[model samples]
Each structure stands twice: as C-alpha cells, then as structure tokens.
Target: MSNTVFCKKFQKDMEALDRAPLPGAKGQEILQTVSKQAWQEWQLLQTMMINEKQLNLMLPESRKYVMEQMEKFLNNEPTDKVTGYVSPDDIVEL
Candidate 1:
C-alpha cells in the first residue's frame, strides 16, 4: 500500500495511516480516504467533544453523535465547537 493518500479533509495528498483506526467499513473508509494528520486532528477533536459534552461511550446515542461529528469533520462541514478550548499552536509563548 502507498504511504500517502489524497486526504479528503485537507483536499490534498498527505501521509496515510498505518492501519485503520476503527473496525469495519467506516474504519476502512477512513483508512483509504483520510490522511494521518486529519485523523490525528479528529482524535483531538473527538477527545475534546467527549470531555466537553460528557459523552458516555457506553451509550449508543453518544457513539452515534460522535460518528456523525466525525463524518461532518472529515467532509469539512461545520461541527460543534469545543468551547473554551484552544490549540497549543495558537498559544503564544513569551
């Protein structure tokens, strides 16, 4: 397999993930279309969403919500923003 993929999110070629992040079709789709950088970004956003929304992964609804968000994110659509959160790169060091 090629080490690069045409990332759907960034709309450019980028490094591909070594393996699918999840199981089944969705994971396979992501592995094929989503770049490693985009996936890593999604992971960060997913963590923030889980923490901010107090999502219980044990619940089907929560998982579904996350999945929906993931789709939107990968498609470059608007998603629920994690309030009060800032990226480390956005932080200015003195």
Candidate 2:
C-alpha cells in the first residue's frame, strides 16, 4: 500500500514521498508532512527559479535563498514572484 500524508501545502491527505527529498532534519520533516505531488511542483518551481535567476547552487547565498523559498512554498505562503514571465501556453497563437 502507498503511504499518505496530510499535506501541509494542500491541506489535505495525499500520496506521500517514498523517502526524504533532501538531507538533514528539514528533509525528514518534509517526508512526514509534504505530499509527493507538492514536492514535484516545488521541484519544477525551484528549477525555474534557478534558471531564470541564474543562481549558482554552489554559492552559499544562492542555496540559502532556495531553501527559504522551499519553506515558503511548503507553508503555502507567498513565494518569490517570477518577474516578467508568461507561460508559453498563455501566448495566443499568432
């Protein structure tokens, strides 16, 4: 049977991740509270933020910024705004 969690992000029960998504205590906490779906969504957003902002994960400040975003994301708080971005699908076919 698949595991389930009361997702903090969605505020509902959902399928749980098979294991911690990251290391350390924060990862363990996420494993217990975050849903698989929410984690996947965060992964995509994180990638976009890294790419659009040209963040160097090797830098401590960049890593810290991403970590802060992660916490806000999981808590359903307002996250960093993606400036001047429009979804490709949102562009009307010319």
lDDT of 1 by residue, 18-91 (tens): 99999999889999999999999999999999999999999999999999999999999999999979878999
- Pairs that clash in candidate 1: none
- Across residues 1-94, which tens digit of lDDT does each residue of candidate 2 receive? 8999999999999999999999999899999999999999999899889998999999999999999999999999999977766888889986
Off by over 4 Å in 1: 88-94
Could you say which candidate leads in lDDT? Answer: 1
Candidates' lDDT values, in order?
0.96, 0.94
Candidate 1's displacement at residue 4, Å, is 0.4
TM-score of each: 0.90, 0.89
Q: How far is candidate 2 from the true structure (C-alpha RMSD, Å)?
A: 1.8
- Show the lowest summed lDDT stretch of 10 residues, model 1: 82-91
User: Which residue runs does candidate 2 get wrong by more than 4 Å?
Assistant: 88-94
